[model samples]
Target chain A: MPEIILIDDPADPRVAAYRDVRERDLVGREGLFVAEGEVVLNVLARSTLCEPASLMIARKRVAGLADLIARLPEDVPVYSASQEAMDAVVGFHIHRGILALGRRRAPASAADMLAGLGEGALVLALSGIANHDNMGGLFRNAAAFGVDAVLLDTDCCDPLYRKAIRVSVGAVLVTPFATAQGDLLEVLTAAGFETVALSPGGATRLVDLKRPSKAAVLLGAEGPGLAASVLARATTVAIPMATGFDSLNVATTGGIVLHHLAFAALRD
Target chain B: MPEIILIDDPADPRVAAYRDVRERDLVGREGLFVAEGEVVLNVLARSTLCEPASLMIARKRVAGLADLIARLPEDVPVYSASQEAMDAVVGFHIHRGILALGRRRAPASAADMLAGLGEGALVLALSGIANHDNMGGLFRNAAAFGVDAVLLDTDCCDPLYRKAIRVSVGAVLVTPFATAQGDLLEVLTAAGFETVALSPGGATRLVDLKRPSKAAVLLGAEGPGLAASVLARATTVAIPMATGFDSLNVATTGGIVLHHLAFAALRD
Candidate 1:
């Protein structure tokens, strides 16, 4: 069982990491990120890839989370504080009354993650998905569709940000993702994966494409879609849309394409 | 041409409807709602179902929006204010430099909207979707996939809410939508539509369902899914998901299911 520490002071050195979370998020959280709410905390406890550094809970909610608290590693400290004190420490009203600080393991290289997947793997590759909400939604969709892994280009936002984690409903904690800097298409191609780039201008419609044994769908950010050079290298497919309508949000687009791949695999 | 009026004072009674928007959103906007940003303003201008009462724009952005401004009805007033003045009036920075007060037409009944769609119509029916962002996203997805119309149970949030309109990229302005107090499924069934209710414990996996000539997908808000009674009245369909995973966001689910129906219709 984890040690239960009592916290009375908002400025306690032990809980210093939890201070002004939103401002810290903007500057970067170094190697650590905060996960909020009971649902996310439960997910954090279950994740094998992420290590929880500590946990903070409202005093009133401790009894409800006893089982979850007991599951933490012996060395991990669990702290309980009055809701007022906890709110002051976090610099926000954490209405859900639970939070955990988690550290990510060293990220796998995109090449390494792709190499580990089986021959029939389904992957989601994203480019320039700078919006944190979109990034979180993509991770949530990837997990729902049973995507093997997600690959992000250098420009993609950090999925571990608190808002992203909350938006994902903790899916980012479970979904394995990696970032690569250059020539993501070349890396994907070299892995023997059939790459399909989603674009408004495409050679084929999404529904018409034959399901491949190993497939990766490439998605770009919302407004400025995939670069022309990137589309040139892959089999370009468009989600058939109403004439003169704006394209679907990038996360929604990813969900549809991933759904197609997932159910297509089930049929095979 | 819209009469361009220069307003120097922030507290001008002419623009009284535009004050403290966030606070006003909580109480209500009477029959009026604000549409912000260039894209949404253009969409609001083109909407035949909604009428714009007035427009408030940053003076600097006037020249760029000349074509859009000219398209507005002659009776509609266009008020241009300096940036600082506009900010003081709206109680927030109007960074997009465009705002329009639009009034919804007296809503059509669910039965009425359903009666108007053709025999091969595709519709989205929603229940208890109170979140503004989800409401907006549903509209955006509906428009992207060419859904003929949207039907909402009385429990759903207002799609005309400012945040919903913004998140939808203005899709809500153009898509025809209606709300009914009870038994929305019955209305669809009476209209000769096959209604499919989305739930995690659905009887049919989404990909396996054959396309119907006229289909309406019923989606519930996340967390508490469709009520058992509601699902009992329609064909319950589940998105085949990975085991132990929560379901997709309601909007994303709508996107995938609608994508299926849209593509299926094309093939037929």
Candidate 2:
């Protein structure tokens, strides 16, 4: 079990990493990201791709989180602070009462990650998804649909962004993901993935598409969807929508498409 | 065209309805809701169910929005303020530069709203969904899927809440919605709608369910899902997910279910 260290001073140097969290989130967190709330901390505890550097918990919550703390490694420090001091340190009132600083393990190349998937694996490929909320939602859906891995184009925002991690409910901690700096479709094709790029004006309806043994659903930002070049190279598909409205929130679209692909795999 | 009334003072009584916009959003808009950004204002302009009471715009954005202003009723006030005055009045940094106070039309009872639907209709029924973002997302999906109406139980939050409206891309303004005070199933059944309640423990997989000519897809909050009483009264269905991972964002679940029902209707 990790040792419980009481912190009365918000400015204590030992807890320096936990200061000005929201500001640091906007600026980069260097190699670390803050995971908030108990549910997310639980995911971080079991995550293999990342390690918890330390934990900062409201003193009142430590008693309730005994089992959760017991699960973490012994060397990791668990800092307990009064609600006032905790609020002072984080520069905000965090009612969730649990926060963990997590560090990513060594990065994996997109090609290497895709090569590791099984023959019939499902994947999600994201391009130009700059919105943190959408990025997080995609990861959450990808985990639920059992996607083997997620590949992102260079233009996509970091899934490890604080809001994305919080929005994803910590799915970013468990789901395997890698950035593909080169042409996403070419790399995907090389890994035996039949890419289905989602678009509003695609020729084929999503329900009518034939399921591939190894598939990747490629999604882009909502308004300017998949790039024309990428769409031409992949199998372009559209989700049937109401006559007057053609757009669905990009993340919602991801959920729908992943559901179709995941269930198709189940039936087969 | 609605006349542009320029106001340099943040305290002008003519634009009193737009004051402390954030606080007013939380403490109820009396009978009005605030719509932000150009995209949502355009939706409000076209909506028949809700009419704009007044508009507050940054002085810089007026020239570009002439076409949009032309669409509003002649009597509706268009108040333009300098960026500083607008920010001071709204109690926030107004980056989107457009805001409108919209008043709901004569309220319709849930039964009456459902009664207005044609023989072949698709509906969404929500219960215990209090999150504004989820509420907005569900409405956005409902609009995208051409849902005839949305039925919310007493436990659901107001869809017209400012955050909900913004998150929905102004879909809440255009989508028809009514709140049910009593049992939701009986109301749906009375309206000649077959209710399909989605839950993690549902007996039937969503993909296998036969499409109903008139259907209402029922959803609950993410954690508890549909209540047992409601679940037993309706045709319960579950989305297939990876083993040990049954949760999907409530709005995402709505999207998948609605997509399935909408596409099935198209195929028929």
Candidate 3:
């Protein structure tokens, strides 16, 4: 069983990872990635591939969760803070009383991500989506729709940011993503992938495309949309949209596209 | 033409309407709302109903835009803050460079919302969605689909909250919405509206709805979903789906439904 120690002090160094998250934003390289709430924390604890380093809970709610709490290594820090201290340490009032902190693992390289695709995997290639919540929602949509991976072409926000993780409702950690694509189309195409760009003004509707051996979707930033150069490379596939909706958020658009492709491909 | 004045001090009361927005969550009673970026600000200034109460611009970037800067009223507060003081006032980073404080107007009531419902009005009824971003996006999607109004059920988050306003890209101000619903079914039935409860396990597909004269979608909170009593009171609509997908965010799901309804209602 993981050791669950009582913590009365907000300043306790033993719970250091759980404190000072906002202050860490000023540090060049020390921002904390926190997952809070029972639903999210439980998901993090179960993601053995990227285990949380420590767990903290409200003192009163720890009784019946003994079995779930035992899954972590005993040496892994587990602190039971009063709800007040839990709120104080987290920078804002997070109602999700339980929080788990994890050291971010190095993200997979874009090249390595392309190499990992199975025969007909679908990947989301984002361009200029700066909002963390939108990125998280995209990942949540991707995971729910069964995309193999998500790749960020330069200028997307960090997927591991606290707000992104929260907006994703814990989907970010479960959905595999990689950043840094040098000439994104070149990279995916070199990896034997055909690129499909989702746009309202495109030449073809989404249903027209049969499954490809491997597919990558190029999505642009929210307003000005995909760069002309970026769209030039991908096959233009528009979602059969309702009139006047010349836009969809990068993530939701990615979701609809992924859903259609997943169904067309007959993938689980 | 609007007047522009530069103020070096953070203490200047002229910019007060736009100050401390992230921290001051309640500005609704004051009848002022903030819109960031040139795009949303421009849109607000152009709209007859919305008016900019103040304008803030970066010192260096103020040179080229004589026309946009000139469009404001002379007495309207236009305080050009140094980038440093600008950051201090807004309570977060100001990457957008320009910000506008606009006058808020009373929303059209649910009855008034129905009175304006032409053949193509798509409305969103908030059940328990309390997240600010979700609330904003729901409103934004409503506007994108030309939704007539969003009716806030009791207990939904305020659309005017800074986070919701910011996240919706200021679509909250553009969309017509009001808060209050005695009974979800009763309101829709009285207004000649079809109330569709959007749930993952719902049996009716959106495409099968046959495009009613006027329709309103009932959406729920993120985690717990629609309360059973509320769902029990709805028409129970579903989006077309593939097998493994769980559900889209309440707003996105609403967006998909609105899009299809609009597509069917209007040929363009």
Per-residue lDDT over A1-268 for candidate 3, one digit per residue giving the tens place of the 0 to 100 score: 8777898888888877766666654453254477767766766776634667787888887885687788877777788889888777766665657777875566678888789887868888887888887887887777666777788876888877877877776777776787765777888888888888877677877656676778887888777787778777678987654343344666666766675676564423
Please give the distance, in angstroms, between residue A210's alpha carbon in candidate 1 and its true position after superposition. 1.9
- The residue-level lDDT of candidate 2 at B64 comes to 96
Query: Residue B60 lDDT in model 2?
Result: 94
Sort the predicted structures by DockQ, highest score first: 2, 1, 3
Q: List the residue pairs that clash in candidate 3.
A: B2-B70, B2-B72
Consecutive 10-residue window with the lowest summed lDDT within model 3 chain B: B238-247
Taking all chains together, each candidate's TM-score versus the true structure is 0.97, 0.97, 0.82
Candidate 2 C-alpha lDDT tens digits along A114-152: 999876789999999999999999999998999889999
Clashing pairs in 2: none
Poorest 10 consecutive residues by lDDT, candidate 3 chain A? A23-32
In candidate 3, how many Å is residue B81 off? 5.7
**lDDT pick, better of 1 and 3:** 1
For DockQ, the strongest prediction is: 2
Q: Kindly list the per-residue Cα lDDT of model 1 for residues B1-268, writing each as its tens digit.
A: 9889998898899888888988898999998989999998888888878889999999999999999998888999999989998999999998888999999777687888899987778999999999999999999999998888999998999999999999998899889999976788888888899898998889988888777788899999999988998888788888888876765898999999999888764325
Candidate 3, CAPRI quality class derived from DockQ: incorrect
* Interface RMSD after interface superposition, each candidate: 0.9, 0.9, 3.5
Residue B88 in model 3: shift from native, Å?
7.7
What is residue B202's positional error in candidate 2, in angstroms?
0.5
Scored against the true structure, residue B96 in model 2 reaches a CA lDDT of: 81
